[model samples]
Target: MSLTSNIADGRKKKRRRMKSDSDISRPSPMQSHIDACVSFKDKQVAARVTSDAKMDEWFVVKVINFDEKTKKFEVLDEEAGDDEEGGVQKTYKLSASCIIPFPERNDPSGTQEFPAGRNVLAVYPETTALYKATVISTPRKRKSDSHVCKLTSNLLCAYLRGYLLEFDDDEEDGALPQRTVPFHKVVPLPEWHRQRDLCIKMRLNSEFGVLNM
Candidate 1:
């Protein structure tokens, strides 16, 4: 994806902490966290921007300056702009709503269980960019560590305790690819968006006369 152009503009990778798998479990970096980050300054965050392709996507950005007076934040994108722009790292002026603070590690037990099949936004491995994905598995136990069980075989046992995520855009000749992402790298979609998506799906089901018992 061509990830530049303004929603006020810029991009990269970042990670933070937070977990809610009960009733509040929905989308990532909850809106409340984003709202409380009003004093955003010198912090790494994920900012949803509108790119040249006209698609909204999340990117990791650093807040270089905050105009408290105007309630606007000036974020610096680590991505050097296009050649015509002299390949300089670009910055963006964005509203608070467009900026999502990284999750905070507030869970004392550190046992947040993300349910399987939940939609989320996870960092694409080896890159800072956040993209839509789904939870394939959330740290389950193996019936047997025998080589027959992929989840229990090899060093993957402890590793499976992290998360098995399937990227939405991952497609290889009609095959879907899954990756093992650390728990910290996965986040729920914002609650609003999650509910919205749910409502849309319900509507489609209703329209097709698909009833759920």
Candidate 2:
């Protein structure tokens, strides 16, 4: 083959290889959704009823079935009293975004643990933001491993139906309002501190600052 033709073929092959690599590195939409969806096996979860006008109350439920095609779950409301077989089980279909899984028992394999007074990044249900919070109460042994967290924000606390609306804050405070949240939603801030520091460092770097700007 001529030198010019050989060079062109090599370049085309390189482009095809790069394109395939990029395609393999990018996750499919369904895979991304599945990765973000909270696993709802045998554990109890809190789900917000979007159909309700207020959308403020969260119903604690157990997952009976998950429909992958619809991305919805068939849940049995635990708060509702039991009824006869097939009689008013209080079942509802909920989307993944509306469901929050309860925290599992502190196991040796996992690092997320809610000890009283410990600072944590809690998933604030009202705003769906992970904010700085303090563990006011730990989970009871018999009950679901849900922890009561006090948000550190100074924003006015509002109670609508059964949900507490609070702002996200990075500051420290002792007088913040408390709300109950699943233990799994409470992440230890220390584990993320290093990443935050690295981000700060990169933002302050001269080259990075100029590039980001």
TM-score for predicted model 1 compared with the true structure: 0.59
> Runs in model 1 with CA error above 4 Å?
1-40, 51-54, 104-113, 139-161, 195-213
Best by lDDT: 1
Q: Tens-digit lDDT track for model 2 on 91-146?
A: 78888766766544333124344566666556676443455566666543213212
Itemize residue pairs with steric clashes in candidate 1: 6-9, 13-128, 17-103, 17-104, 27-188, 27-189, 28-188, 28-189
Model 1 local distance difference test score? 0.68
How do the residues 1-213 of candidate 1 rate in per-residue lDDT, one tens digit apiece? 343543223321211123233335663465545455555677778887654434667887889876656767889888777899999987888877677765433331443456888887777888778887888887553233455346344444533446788898699889778887766566667776677678989999897885554
The TM-scores, one per candidate, come to 0.59, 0.44
Residue 37 in model 1: shift from native, Å?
2.1
Instruction: Give the Cα RMSD of candidate 2.
Output: 15.4
